[model samples]
Target: MWYLNDDLVDSSYHAENENQVINHISVPNIQRSQHRANLECRARNTVLISPVSKTVSIELNLRPLSVSILQRHSQLSTHTQYEITCESWGSHPPPTLLWFLEGQELKGVTTEESRSSNTSVSRLLFTPTPEFDGKRLICRASNPLLPGTAIEDFWQLRVVYSPILSLRLGSSINPNAIKFQDDVYYECVIRANPPAVKLTWYHNGENLKHTPTSGIIMSNQSLALQKVTRASAGIYVCSATNNEGEGRSNPVELKVMYAPTCRNDLSSAEGTPVIIAASRSEDVNITCEMDALPESLRFHWAHTNTVGEAVDLEPEIYTSQGSKSFLFYNLRSEEDFGTLLCWAQNSIGTAERPCIYQIVPAVDISNYKQYPNYGIKHSFSSSPQFPRHG
Candidate 1:
């Protein structure tokens, strides 16, 4: 005779009514699962029932959420600790917040939520190094309602660091073979977080001024020599600087190419007919050099004996970087004693230098009294009588 939720109440759900046809059912809480429940009333006469009377529908909705990162500094110092905070605002079912660096998920995160606004904030602690400069970080918020889908925000990190520079000569000519009139170029390669603002060039510890019209093409990153000479050859240094700090590179040597020149000063002692005093069996090495340029050269050694006779003797000659060196090994004090002349010739021209080998014998001075006129007399009939530094 009575029904609760379209089910016949077996005298338990019966309520006191005047016609004894009313029943009641109590559900403590009606949730989404219990939505659209029907209730009816019927007169029990040979299994007779009435149509369902009432039904209800329940509607559920959640708030919208957004994820964002808090901007603290535009340029952060490298190798320094920083707190990156991400926030998810106003979400129902509590949107999950996560931190990502360049699409990679991060761990060890701490999250807190606002009780009234339903906003969750997550903080990630990080220390950025120089290798991590110019990278991007991200924060994401995902709802449980929408699985596998998330909203993300990103920030490109500009971590500041000192400049690292490497200066190198950009040229096709070999340094040892560089010749006069050959063009040369130099460039500075730099890497930094904020990047180097400027670069400077120096030659032999002196700053090189720009002389564009004078064939010296000097720029911030490049130093070009259109026409190289002996004055243009030196150690070139490059320096780079930024707001963070400055950096210096290893100096590069630029040698101008030309014909060979005798370096008699480095041979033995300095003189016009460069007088080289040496004892018998002493190592006598003569050398000459030009501003190293790429060119083949011929070396010839001629020795003028004490008898005023010139004979071409085989001298040990070593050539390198526009310079040539000759070594005299095991002189006999009498046979190797002579006026030595070295001639160097290239495609450009030829240059000559002279040397007088005074081979003194290692003998007892008291023996000179026993042997009168035992040594050859010093004479320069054709050469200069008075020696001067070359």
Candidate 2:
């Protein structure tokens, strides 16, 4: 008869030319609770005399049944520290535990074992960075006696990070060659966790608003600039906001090119022609200034009578320097008393409108009252004539 843990073994065979019987016992689905169980073999004839028995204890080397992370956190923040624990059960001599992030081994992990409970626990101290978002964190348990048998549990990290933004020019537009009245646009690309909730645009350090009537249209991630002018050339920026924080992009400068135009600041009566009073046969120096890109400018002067007759003035009477032109004119007769126009040209094109000056006869100041020596008498000849120079 054979018994294991007080259970009889059903199969036995006699050894040839030996005074002994060999018994075979099969146990299925052994559990960790059954480790070190006693197994006994005994010999008896008809229940007579005491049975001769041999006993032994069962020993087993087992791989861990499962591995899991304990004290798990739902969220992790950048620049903050957090501690996590992992535990494994049902491994003989306690399983070796380790931590990993995105397939890379993690250091400074502390591991402890419980012989009574057949459990292994490991603790990991971690500090998350913005770049660590969405990475995989793993807890692995392996038995030293069992090679190639490792169990693991993993978590997808949900790290909270500030928004990332980039502002770019719209496709199909050349940044270096933007011209006046050209339609332009910009795009804002964003990368963030928890997604972006708001977006803003800026120009020249001032926040911009959506003003469609003024040709500035804006959306959550884009801006459309209709009919851009020289005023539109400036530094532009984009920003995005999320639950974590706000982030701003680097500045992008827009340069607009255009032809010559009259400088409004230097003009009197705005765009209307300026009136100059001068005497006949008097020499006058008229100056014309313009604003344009590429600075270099070519100027032309012309004269027109009230009857609409016009003639281009000779270039020898005018000298141009950069964006300004100086014209020396001799108003010798009534024919020179009409309108004088100045036009400028650059690489872009000719000026859309010329700077105009209306030449009229000066008010007569030929006679003045004289008092003692305190005031000096001033007078002009009835027929004033000044020498003319080519």
Largest TM-score belongs to which candidate? 2
Q: What would the per-residue lDDT of candidate 1 be over residues 1-390, giving only the tens digit for each residue?
A: 344465665444454776555655454555533334454444443445644444433333344358889965787886478888888875656678888778678888898888576688899888776765667788888877867667889888878887877878785657776667778888878887677887777889998778888778877688888878878888998887888788788888887756665453444444434334445555556554432244466666677766778877664343433355444444555767657666667765665444334333333223323433232222222322322112
Query: Estimated TM-score per prediction?
Result: 0.54, 0.56
Per-residue lDDT tens digits of candidate 2, residues 90-174?
8886898988898899999898888778888899998888777888899999988999889899999889877888888988889
lDDT of 2 at 202: 95
Worst 10 residues of 1 by lDDT: 380-389
Question: What does each candidate score in C-alpha RMSD?
Answer: 10.7, 10.6
